[model samples]
Target: MKQTIEQLADVELTENMLKIAKRELREDKCSREQSLEQMRNWVLKHEDLRNVRLDDQFLLRFLRCKKFSVPMAQQTLLKYLNVRRTFPHMSTQLDFLDQKLNDIISSGYIFASPNRDKHGRRVVVINAKGFNPKIYNSSDQARAHFLTYECLMEDQATQICGLVHVGDFSGVTTTHVTNWNPTEFARVFKWSEQSLPLRHKEIHLVNVPATLKWLIDFVKGRVSSKIRNRLTLYTQDKELAKHVDPACLPQELGGQMPLKAIVELWKAELLAKRETILNLDKIALLSDRGILRKSNYSSEKSSNGMNFVSQIESIEGSFRKLEFD
Candidate 1:
C-alpha cells in the first residue's frame, strides 16, 4: 500500500516536471523555434550558399540548426519549388508525379485513386498521405484541357483513338450532370435538332421542337439532303459543333454524323420512327379511295394474289420437274 501511494506521487511529480519543461520551451526567450514563420525564414534566409536546389535537398541539417518541425522544412521547399515554370513534356509530368508518389510511399502513406482521362492517360494532381484519388465532375473538361495543352506545348499528333472519352464511351447522357439546368437542356436540345442532320424528310419531319426527347428519334437514319441541314443547324453553335462534327449530325439534329460508319445506326433509328406520322398516313390509305374509282390503271392490274399465287406456283413447278426428268 505504501509503495503504490509513492508510485502515484512519483507519477504526479513527473507529470508536473514535464509540464514545466514544455512551458519553458514555449516561453523561453532563447527558444530556437519561436513560430513557423521564423523557422521557414531561417532556411530561406541563407539563399546565397547552396550545393543543391531547395526542392531536391533535405532540410534535416537546416531543421537541426533552426530547431523546427518537419512542416517548416516542407514549407520552404513548397514556397520555392511551386513557383518554377512547368516543363512542356508528358514525360516530365509523369516523372514529377512518380517522384511525388515515391515521397508519399516512403512516408508510409497509402496512395489514393488516380484519374484517367478519356484517352486512358492519367495526370496526377495531388499526392497527400492516405488520401484516395478522385475523378471529379470536371474530369472531362480537364481532359479536354490536357489534350489542348499537349497539342500546344508538344505539337504532338492527336490520335483519334486517344480522343475516346474514358467514362462516357457512349455519349455523355443527361443523367451524368444532374445539376444541369432543365431549361438549358431544352434550349440545347432545340439547338442540336436544328443543327443536326435532317435527312429523309418523311421521318425527320416528326422531330418537333416540343419535348426534346424526340431528338433521340434520329439516332439511326440514312443520310439525305435534309439530314445535313438538321444536324448542322442544331449544332450551329460553332464551338460545340466543332466537337460533334456538323457534317454528320443525327437527322433530328440537322447533320449526319457520318454515313459510312454510322449509316446502319441511322437506318435502325429511321425504321424505328417510321410509324410515327408519315408511315401512318401511307398505311391507313383506303383501297376504295383509288382502285375502285373506275381507274383504267386498276382494271389492268387486278390481282390480290390470294389464290393467284398458288396458280403461279403450279406453273413454276411444271417447268422445274420437266427439266429434272
Candidate 2:
C-alpha cells in the first residue's frame, strides 16, 4: 500500500502547521478529502491522461498549490504532464544513478538543504559556479535541477509552506552566461511560474557580479509580480543572512554544516527516493488524444492566468543581445 503523507518520513504536519495550511492555503481537513477525490476522478475521467498517480498524497500537492481549486489544480496537472512530454530530453531518463546526473549532484550544483527556514519553507541552493558548461550542457544542468525539485516537492511541508531559493552566482563567467539561450531560460522560468505546482516564497541571489546583474532584471520581467516582489539580490553572504536565517543555510552561506556535507546528505536523500523519482515518467499524456496540439503548453494561460510565453517572447530581441555582444 502507498504510504499516507503523514506516514512518510520527514513529514511533520503538526497542529500549528495544519492551522497555517488552512489559513494560507485553505486546506481544511474536511473539504480536502472531497477535493482530493474530485481531482483523482477528474484525472481518471480525462482520456488524455494515462498512468497518472491516483494516490491522495500525490494529488494533494496539486490541490494545495492551487489553493484547493479543482479546475486550477487540473490545469496545472495537465501542464505538468505536457511539460515533461514537450521537453523529453530534460525530463526523461531521470535516473539518479546516471553518471552525468550523479556528477552534477556530487559537484553540489543544486540541492535542497535538509533543513527548513524559520518560516518552514525548504531552502533550495543553486551554485552557478559548480556547473561546468564544457562538461555538461544546459539540458544536463536543467535535468539536475528538475530532479532535485521533484524530490523536494514530495514532502507535504514543502507543498504547504513553499520554497526559498538561494542562488549563489559567485565565480560565474562569460561561459556560464553563454551556456543557456534565451528561449531555454524563458521556457524554464515560465514553466516554474505557471505550470509547476510550487509556491516560491522567496528568491535570494547573492554574490551577483555587475556583469550578470542584467540577467536578474531579465528574470524579474518573466515571473509574476508576487515572485518578483519576493525576489532579493545580495552582494555578499552577510547581507543574505539579514533576511534568511543563518541556520537554514549551509556553512558556505554562514550556516552550521559545511556545504559539502549538506550536498552529501542531499545526495543520500535523492538516492533513497531513486525509484520514486524515476517513476515520475509514468505520468504520461497521450499525444494522439489531441489534448496537447497547442503551440506551447507553457504559453497557454490558466484561469488565474498570464501569457508568460508572449511576455518572454516579446523580450527575445533584448535577450538575443547575449548572442551578438
Best candidate, lDDT: 2
What TM-score goes with each of the models? 0.16, 0.88
lDDT of 2 at 320: 42
User: Which lDDT tens digits does candidate 1 get at residues 110-190?
Assistant: 111122233322211111212222322222222222222222111111110112111101222233333223333332333
Q: By TM-score, how accurate is candidate 2?
A: 0.88
For all candidates in order, the CA lDDT equals 0.27, 0.80
Q: Model 2, range 164-202, lDDT digits (tens) per residue?
A: 999998877666666677667777766656767888999
lDDT of model 2, residue 60: 79
- Which segments of candidate 2 are over 4 A away from where they belong? 1-11, 287-325
Candidate 2: worst 10 consecutive residues by lDDT? 316-325
Specify the highest-TM-score model's number.
Answer: 2
Measured with C-alpha atoms, the lDDT of residue 203 in candidate 2 is 92
